[model samples]
Target chain A: MQYKDYYKILGVERGAGQDDIKKAYRRLARKYHPDVSKEPDAEEHFKEVGEAYEVLKDPEKRAAYDQLGSQWQTGEQFRPPPDWNAGYEYSGGFSGDDAAAYSDFFESLFGFAGRAKTGSTGAGFHAQGQDTHARILIDLEDAYRGATRSISLRHPQLDATGHVALRERQLNVNIPKGVYAGQHIRLKGQGESGMGDGQAGDLYLEIGFNPHSIYRVDGKDVYIDLPVTPWEAALGEQVTVPTPVGKVNMKIPPGSTQGKQMRLKGKGIPAKVAGDFYVVLQIAVPPADTDTARKAYETLKQAAGFNPRQHLEKQS
Target chain B: MKNHDSAPTLNGEVLEDYCLSLQQLCHGATAEPEFILQLVEYEVLVPQGGQEAEWRFRAEDLARLRRAQRLTRDFELDLSALALVMQLLDELMELRGSG
Candidate 1:
């Protein structure tokens, strides 16, 4: 196993005080926390920082690690000198959940020394299995009309010897109608493998819609910007608009202004829960370059007597 | 910190293995930092001085920078579009771990 230089990871001197170590950890953690950071390796960096703080933040662990000698190169072959931890008394051994997340190298040094504590249970008992998580992107139509999708997932399976092996399986998922983006679908027994005869953790599937050419989705509502001619907007017209389910006739209200939004009830993608569809009207002005078009515009301007910006009276 | 080779070993504790200076880490790893800077509103790289001015990078910084670069060059994403992708990636990872 490779050795990690926690000092280097945390960017601190070996003799750095606890407060210094903590301040560095807090600074780095905020910069790299997977949730808030946009750095590509934020997740890996977060893990490394967490691991570093895991050792250095604790006085006992830090001292024991310092005793290992600075000459031992990082990732160099390591064998803890016999009874290196002999006289060191570690108060409050590592909790069970944390021990499991620590590396084998860490576990080798600290695992055996800690007294495993399982509190307030039967003589011997365990609970709270690991949760399973997955992400799936479905088409907008799938949400509108619902779908039974065959999803293929590859997950790690640990062998009897405890080495992980990649295993693939196919599951048929029932996509409930009208599921919006960012929603979750949970399935039992779809997560990390269970431990010690315990029930498997729940699997959470985060919902995402594939980029659609015809639609833009916003939280239970769908918006499609449709282009209409000036004449079509001025004199109301019925046009065929594309909805998630199918193409339908939508009425453009008379004297509609440019950039006006029109709604089609119950025409959006339908699922178990349904959202409304909105058609944003974009007026397409006819080019006046042609003589016929220029004559038409001249006639209209003379007849209509319209002054679009007449309201803007500059005080200065 | 040196320009040792094009490929870095994926394992072990060598400087090349664990982390590298900014330039070495980003060498050919990304398209350019021009657009990525627009996304974060942060100037990603600054000169360290002399010959090393363009030669500094931390592993954490380089990894995400490279990923951002890939989303633009390899994935053909615009700045606004890349922001959306980055946002979704964060959300996706959270859902993955929590689930």
Candidate 2:
């Protein structure tokens, strides 16, 4: 596994004080907070920043981490020396589920709480695992109809000598239909395993939608802008529109102008209370480049009854 | 083609079908029950029970409570100010959605 530099991740020098480390962490946290940040990879960046903060925040963890020396470069292949954690003692309250997010390097040194407790052979020792949380990004179409997804989670395993081994377990999850963004799905008994007789904690996956170029969501409603020619807007025409479910024919009424909204009932997100899908009309005027087109435009101009700029003239 | 045996497939329940009660919400958010009750009183999380013991919160409320925890703990925001910020943020998101 590759060596991870906690100091480098936090953008702080080795000689920096605890206050400086905290200052740097807060700046990064605010920039990458999933709720507020507009960045494309905000969630990933948030998780990584959080991991760095978790290690650097505690004084004991910092001291232990610093003893590893500054010889190793980031991403260098590294293995911890046997008995590396000799003198210092860790009263590990960090449940295995808490350490599930950190990289293998962190797990190797500090040990996974989940694994440590689970592997305990001591009589009458029992501890419940901490619950874990993660965000899952899916396409909007997946919300309309259920889809299957595979995700790899980092976890710690116990070896014979009670050493922690970083393990990546992949699970195929079946996402149910009609789950909108911001809603969470609960997976019972899928999180960190309980120690002794304790019950395993649950896992919660928050849903987020991948950005779609054509459609946008509000609550359960879906919105899209449909382009129509000038003639089609003036004289009604039957048009085929695309929705998450499928394509359907929509009849545009006569004199349907630009900015007109047509609501398709029960076509938004499929939920208990289905939301309507809105089509916002945008008129596209063809350019008069050829002789036939120019003549057609001239004929329309001659036949026009009133000027469109009359409202502007009235305002002036 | 080989038959894929022993491949694990898991199905998760949606938030509407099964949600967290007051005690579970407290455990999940890592907040005390008193604070959650205060939030409920403030209408930050409008739960579906007449009493604290019977209150059940949806996933959306849980998400809001989590955010509220961070704002109040880290940023030191009062409940009233937090409510205003929440409203403004919701409006901002709605405006962005319209565009």
Off by over 4 Å in 1: A1-16, A34-45, A60-135, A148-172, A191-198, A210-214, A284-307, A310-316, B1-99
When summed lDDT is taken over every stretch of 10 residues in candidate 1 chain A, the lowest stretch is A115-124
Model 1: how far residue A73 lies from native, Å: 10
Task: Locate the minimum summed-lDDT window of 10 residues in model 2 chain A.
Answer: A92-101
Candidate 1 per-residue lDDT, tens place, A194-294, comes to 45566766555557788888788876789998999988999999999988777899888889998898887666666434578999999988899999999
Which candidate number has the best DockQ? 2
Interface RMSD of each: 21.2, 4.8
Q: How well does candidate 2 score on lDDT at residue A19?
A: 96
Clash list (residue pairs), candidate 1: A40-B64, A41-B64, A132-A191, A177-A271, A177-A272, A178-A271, B21-B57, B22-B56, B22-B57
Task: For candidate 1, give the lDDT of residue A158.
Answer: 42
